[model samples]
Target: MSNLLAKLISMKYKGKSNIKEYIMEISNLASKMKTLKLELGEDLLMHLVLISLPAHFRQFKVSYNTQKDKWSLYELISHCVQEEERLWRDISESTHLSSTSQNKKRKKTKGAAEGSFQQKKPKKDEEFTCCFCKKSGHMKKECPKYATWRVKKGLLVEPTAK
Candidate 1:
């Protein structure tokens, strides 16, 4: 009986389980203490629950301690449960905001990649050769063969010397 009571007193809260479940577990231990002819009042039960809570609830414990308001077991449970919900809500909201921003960034990067898919412009220093005359020094525009062909086809008139 003493060992069970000690176990109840020493139990610590693990974050993996829900706060409500933890509270229920503590309540059961307190009930067992009562059956064993031990005195386990609501106030003591509340104290045990508060102390057994994880370090995440440090702020909650501090606020509860500083205030003049004396909360019963039911009121404490309600407040703790609300605090748990608020903590998770804030976490989920921040995660959602970050994911949305990441998606927007991904879309912008994809758009930039698509724009770059077009053919790249040739650099200024790079020279092109004439395909018509098979020459390396000049382009098709300045090729003699092309000039003669254009003149014969009447596409361009011969220039007269000044």
Candidate 2:
């Protein structure tokens, strides 16, 4: 019986487990202890349950503690069940909101990429004629003779377009 109580004290709540199921397990253990000629107080059992809750319920614990009226086991269970529902609802809503926002962002990014593509200027290449030499395949700034002259004049040479 002491071992069972020790186990109950050591048990901790996990977020992945159903909260109601966890409470049922506690009730079963307490009942077993009772059948063994040991009686556990309601307040002590409630406190034990509270202490065993996961860290995610820290805020709930704070709120519960701040309440003036001492709650019975049934009252605590009702509040906990309500809290569990609230927790799951918040999780589902946040997931849906995030997915919607992510899809919007992806569409915006795709549209921006397409817009930039259309705005891109034609590539400068061999198709262009050099203004200086009247020859094909280059620009005015890319004339070899002009570049040599600039170098001789101690002026920096402008790079030719490939």
Candidate 3:
């Protein structure tokens, strides 16, 4: 009997199991204690259930404490189940948002890398011709010979040390 009472007192809801199941398990222990002539009040059992919940239920616990109306065992179970669903929904939404943002970032980086490669490869149909040197495979602005001619002609400024 003492062992049962100690077990009931020490029981904790670690969130590994379903909230309903955990609550029922605690109620079952309380029932067993009642059969042993160690009856625990409904209010006391409610407090025990709240105390057993994990840290994530801190807000729920606080809300329950601050409210004037008290909850029965069944009401407590219902509210806890709702709170658990809310918590799970919040977590899933945040996970989805993070993954979506990460995917967008990856696509942007991939597009930039592919764009750089595309820019480096010239189109087959467009043959570059240097207007100044009359040379194929090169443009006038990119022609080394044209640049030297411009430097000699004083059209292009030679870089000077600041």
Candidate 4:
């Protein structure tokens, strides 16, 4: 999937880059994995996406869909498309086996009615930013990204935020 994502990202849509820029670009892959829910770590993500480029492209959404009961990425997408087509066709009978599935479809027919459950809600977590580094991980005041070469007045500043 990481390889596929790289192919997608690099599909001539991302413009251009160089060696140093690519290195720094690779460093932020961890955040990309977390945000994209790719279920991959930083180093491996970079290796697959950056290094493994063309060869693994076909692994993007290959096989996996067993009638014995199993699903793969491609299978899942095909199943979704089939279900959508069925809905579009307005089938009188459902193609799925689940009884609960029929119940939901019935409810969508209007005025069938249903009950909702009440439950305790968890408290939200507080979000914080670094004061020293003025960044998320480190403090704003101590941010290394803010450092400048040949310091002055025991202080340094970054020319640009990016």
Query: For candidate 3, lDDT tens digit of each residue in 1-162?
Result: 999889988998887889999999999999999999989999999999999888999999999999999999999999999999999999999999999999999998998988953545458997887778898889888888987888899999864659
The global C-alpha lDDT for each of the candidates, from Candidate 1 onward, is 0.86, 0.85, 0.91, 0.44
Global CA lDDT computed for model 2: 0.85
| Regions of candidate 1 where Cα sits further than 4 Å from its true position | 104-122, 126-162
Worst 10 residues of 1 by lDDT: 115-124
Clashing pairs in 1: none
Model 3 CA lDDT for position 159: 48
lDDT at 95, model 4 = 42
lDDT of 4 by residue, 1-162 (tens): 577466435542121343233334444554565677765544354333333233322333232212344554234435534544444354334444456687777767544343333333334563345554455644445565455322554555435656
Counting clashing residue pairs in each candidate, in order, gives: 0, 0, 0, 10
TM-score of each: 0.61, 0.67, 0.66, 0.20
State the displacement of the C-alpha of residue 4, model 1, in Å, after optimal TM-score superposition.
1.8
Model 1: per-residue lDDT, tens digit, 1-162?
Answer: 788788888999887888888888888888887888987888888899999988888999999999898898778879999989988898899999999999999988897899864655457786766889887778789888898899999999975669
Q: How are the candidates ranked when ordered by lDDT, highest leading?
A: 3, 1, 2, 4
